[model samples]
Target: MTAAVESEAPAEVLPGLYDIDAELYHSDPIPGGSLSSSGARKLATECPAKFKYWSEHPQPVKKEFELGTAAHTLILGDGPELVVVDAEKWTTNAVKAEVAAIRAEGKTPLKPSDLKRVTEMVAALRADPDAAPFLEPGSGVAEQSAFWEDHGIWRRARFDWLRHDGQLVDYKTTKSANPSDLPKVIHDWGYHQQQEYYLDAGLALDLVDPEKPFQFVLQEKEPPYLVVVTTCDPVARGIGRHLNDRALNTFALCRASGEWPGYLEAPLTALPAWVERQYA
Candidate 1:
C-alpha cells in the first residue's frame, strides 16, 4: 500500500509579494518590478529619474545581458536551454524564421560565434582546478532563485550555483579577467553587495551553508577566455553590507515619501576629487 502524503500549507508571503519562483521569474514582465540587488545598486548611485525609469518601465534584457545569460545556461544547465543560429547564415529567411520562432517561444537566441566563445570559456573553467569542481556532477543547486525580506522590503536573488560545501559560484563574463584589476571591478559592479545580499537570502531560508563563502568565476569575453576564481575579502563584504544597508534605507525613504530626486542642484565650479587629487 502507498503511504498517504500530507500537504503543507503555503508560505505566508504578503499580498503583491512573491518570493522566488524560478519557473515564472524570467518569463514575467519587468516594468514596475520589485527591488533586487542590481536595482538596489543602481538606486544607490544613479540619478533618481533613471532609477525610477528602471522601476516603472518595462525592461527587455539587453543583447549583451542575453549573451552573458546564454553563457551561464550553456555552462551550467542540463537540458537544451537556448536556440542558437550560425551568424554567417543568419541573414537567410529560414534562419530569420528560426530566430523569430525562438523569440516567439520566449527562448534566448544566440549566434554561432557566441556559442563558440561560451564553449571556449567553459573549457577554460573546466581546466581551472577551482572552478571545475564547481560544475561537477551533483554540484548542488543550479539557477536557484530566492526571495526574502530585507529591512521589511522584498528583495530577490537568483543564484547561479550554491555548492554543498557552502561556496556560491557565479559566472561572470568580463573584458578582462586579470586578478590584479578585479578589486575595482568588484567595487564598481556592486558585486560585493550581491554577495552579502545573496547570502542573506540563502542563510535566512536555510538554503545554503552559512559558513562557506562565495566564489566568482570570472571569464574574459575575448579570444583566450581566461578564467579566474576569486572572492570578496571580508573587509569588502563588510563594506558591501554597509552599502546594502544604505541602499535599503534610501529605498525605504523614497517609497514612503514617493519622492525620487535627480542630480544635485549645486553646479560644478571645479574639477572633481580624482582630478584634484591627481594635481595635489
Candidate 2:
C-alpha cells in the first residue's frame, strides 16, 4: 500500500509506504522526529554528538557521489533527472554556473563523459544474469520510503528497490565489488546493520517475508563495471539486529535527556592484537 505525498504537509505522518520525493524524505518531516537506518548506524558506530550535529546540518553533495546518483537514476528509472553538461572540464565559469543552476532546480548535472560512463555501467549491470532479473523495470518499485514504529520510536527507511515478489534489493557503487573485499567493506560501512534495519522496516509493515534475506547488488565504478549480487548471512544479520537495538535505545535516551554525549574521555586503550603480535 503506497500513499502519495500531498502538496501540503500532513498534520501527522502516518505509518505506511510512501511515494515521496527524496528531498522531502531526507528532510524528516515526521512528527516528533524519526530515526533512519543511517542515523541508527551513526549513533551505534560513532558518538551521539556527531550524529546529532550532522543530523541538524545536512552535508553538501560531493562530486564523487554524482556518478553513483546518475547511475541510480538510469538503472532504477527513478530519482532526480540527470542533466548532461557538454563540457570536457568544469573549470570554466559558465560550466560551473550551469552546474550550480541545475542543482538549484533539484536536477543532477553530469559531464557528458561521466554520463556516458554511467550509461555503460548500467549496461554492464543489466547483463548480469543474477542481478538482471531483480532490477527488471516493471518488476518492482524504486526509491520507495517506508515508515513505521519500532519499540516506541518512529523508524524510517528508503529502499532502492522493492520487488513485487517480496524481495528487498539495495544497489551500491564501490571502488571494488570483489567478493573477497566485500566482507571488510560490509563491516566498515555497517552494511549488515543497514540490511537488518531495512528488513525491519519491511517486516513491520508486512512488505517483506521473514524468510527472505535482504539482497545487495554491488557494482564497481571503474572499467568493466563488474556487478556482484549477495546477501547477509544469519550471523551477520544477528549482529546487525543487536547493534540496531542498542542504537535505538541510545537514541531514545539521548532524546529524552537532551544530551548527546561524545566518546569516553581519557580512557586507556590498547593496541590492536595484530599490531602487538607483529612486534612480538
Best by TM-score: 2
Residue-level lDDT of model 1, residues 126-231, one tens digit each, is 7888778876757665765565665567676667776766667788888787988999889889899998888877776666666667788888877677888888
* Model 2: lowest-lDDT 10 consecutive positions: 1-10
Q: Which stretches of candidate 1 lie over 4 Å from their true place?
A: 1-23, 26-33, 78-80, 89-101, 273-280
Worst 10 residues of 1 by lDDT: 1-10
lDDT of each model, Cα atoms only? 0.71, 0.88
- Residues 140-222 of candidate 2 have per-residue lDDT tens digits of 88988888887788989999998887789999999889999999889888999999999888888888766767899999999
Among residues 3 or more apart in sequence or in different chains, the pairs in candidate 2 whose N, CA or C atoms overlap within 3 Å are: none
User: What value of lDDT does candidate 2 attain over all alpha carbons?
Assistant: 0.88
